[model samples]
Target: MKFPKVQLALVQMRDAGSKTASIAAATTWIERAAAEGAQVICLQELFATCYPCQAEDHTMFDLAESIPGPTTDALAELARRLEVVIVCPMFEKRAAGVYHNTVAVLDADGTIAGIYRKMHIPDDPLYYEKFYFTPGDAGQPRASVGPDKPNGFNVISTRYAKLGVGICWDQWYPEAARLFALAGADILLYPTAIGWIDEEKEEFGAGQLDAWMTSMRAHAIANGIFVGAPNRVGIEGRVEFWGNSFIVSPRGEVIAKANSADDAIVTAECSLEEMDVVRTHWPFLRDRRVDAYGDLTRRFID
Candidate 1:
């Protein structure tokens, strides 16, 4: 299959005090990226609001909005005007007392293409995502929205690219990346909001950051697809958000990376044709022993 070279952009920035401010700032960055020739752009997770996963508060539920609500509406219009594919993460209010960490993909025409609800909800010390999000169900391949296909991961097709979007925690799981790649996603986009806990920084900051970047790069190399991660920056409460947003090519090369201290937008041209060459040379998928991998389904081999 022939693919065109696309300019991928990631907007890495600290959250402004207000939603209006954050969105406005993101708009400016998006415009800048477009002006610089970016065809596909991704914003940090929950760009419209602060990282609410910092704590489990009832008020945070109010921040969740419908997928086609005001936020998506505005973004759709902006995407159409800019003629760029946008992968935007948000706190989704599916219904009363029901919500999910979802990212909606907007096509170049400014239409709602599809949504990918976070499948993994982590409940660590400061990150309380499980408290707010209902895990998405990934059922049979290409299943409908019925009970069988509750949390279907959608690979949105747009004029610029086929996007496979996952939230922060989802980036750690290779299964998600593989599934998306198998489903024909040319680019894997992870809109993230991750940082160092002040207390842990002195001990594990460097290692954690290395592991984070290493894991994402592995996904790009193994899947033979472009990986784009747009992370939040600045200190918010006990968490000092590490910025370093980046884009990695199929060969696991870091095409562009942002600084760890400030608001930035970085863009790079991703050669989609390289994926075929890399995969052909690597041939990991072609050599996979699928029949012998049943143990992967078990909780513990023991």
Candidate 2:
């Protein structure tokens, strides 16, 4: 099967307060990318507002909106006008007290294509995602050790490509990436907000960033698929986001990368042909012993 050679744009931007400013910035970036011939564009996570997970304030809930609400509507219109597929991540308010970290996909025709909720909610220091988001039930088990098993991966097909959307913390897990690849995703897209804590900046920031990039690159190599990460830039509260948004080829090469602290659009052209070529050369998928990996369902072997 032959797929089109798709051009992807990763919009790396700083947090903004008003929807107007964020949308404006996104418009400019999208226009720039479209002029450069990008067919698919993705923005950083929570691009419309500052990373609210920084501190738990009930008032932050006001930022949440429905799928077809103002933000998505505007993005869908822009996508149709530009004739590009747009992936917009939003803070979703499903109900009064229920919310999720969701990414809405707008097709080239300006229609709402699909929505993928963040399944992994991290509750680490400086990142309090679990306090606000209800981890997405991808119809899977919550615990690896339990009798219940996760359905593996959630896959979505866009007008341009078969995509797998995962949020910030989800980027750290190989299980998520592998499952997405196994489910037939041609591209793994991660809308992220990873950064350095004020105190950790001097001690381990560089190492942390290196590890992050290394992991994503490994995902591309292991899965034989293109991987793209659109991360936020600039400082917000106790965290200083390390932009460095990038696109990696199926060969695990960094084709395009943005600056660590700049708002820029990184574009890369991915050929589905390359994925097939790489996978054929390195048959990781063909060699997988699925029937012998039941221990992966456990949290820890010990």
Candidate 3:
């Protein structure tokens, strides 16, 4: 269970106004990550398209594409050529009207490893995900309250590492991270598109970003696994997407971090031995109270 040292890369970039432009920009970044010796690379959520969930527009449904559609086809070729693991998030067109916010993991050989649909759909202001996406399977009733799917918190095994993929809102939930850790994921990758709504920037921006990062860092500390999050980095509409994408070690140490307002590629060398050391010292998983957490399934503990 010893993972070798891995050069993890987070491609943090701004949207280029159009899907074609965005894809091209991401392609360049991916190539850059590979050239810099990043064995595993993850792009921001919806890298092919700008953040379109700002408002519930019926036309936005056009953005959804099949899992093996054009985007993955292009990424697959790139992954094969570079021989690097790629984690790509896209708006999926499951059926006619059904869509899910999912990330398709491409193995180093360019094969589709698996897709993790966003389990927790947030419905807050400026982030109307429920309007467009259906939540992914959360296992039976007790494991999760979301709709059931055959793939529940799947951990994909690629040539480089076993990745537990999660989307933006999923990062806010500890259950998502714990499930991945327990399932033997070497690292947790969150492809996110979160930002500050223009109106709330002055008051809650700093706190919001701190909470977002703190939660993910806590996951790394608790699970004793690497955590890599690549976030969008520009103002699309009302929200200014905070870039600050980063990688953290098992002990919650910041390995590499991007600037808050810049398009950059952040890379860090993470040692698998560090994970074992941290987990041995702080054996939280070994002392979990699993038998007493049955009520976690209830809607409210009333």
Per-prediction TM-score to the true structure, in the order listed: 0.96, 0.94, 0.95
lDDT of 1 by residue, 1-302 (tens): 24488899999989898888988898999999999999999999998998897788998898889978888888899999999988888999988888988888888888887888889889998999989999986675554643113345557777878888899999999988998898788899999999999889989999999999999999999999999999999988888899999999998999899989999997899888889999999998898888998998899988
- 1 or 2: which has the higher lDDT? 1
> lDDT of all predictions, in order shown?
0.88, 0.87, 0.88
Ranking by TM-score: 1, 3, 2
* Candidate closer to the true structure by TM-score (higher is better), 1 or 3: 1
lDDT score at residue 132, model 2, on the 0-100 scale: 92
Residue runs of model 2 more than 4 Å from their true location after superposition: 1-3, 140-152
Give the lDDT ranking, best first.
Answer: 3, 1, 2
Give the per-residue Cα lDDT of candidate 1 at 61.
90
Best by TM-score: 1
Give candidates' CA RMSD values in order: 2.1, 4.1, 3.0
Candidate 2 backbone collisions, by pair: 141-150
Clashing pairs in 3: none
Q: How many clashing pairs does model 2 include?
A: 1
Off by over 4 Å in 3: 1-3, 140-150
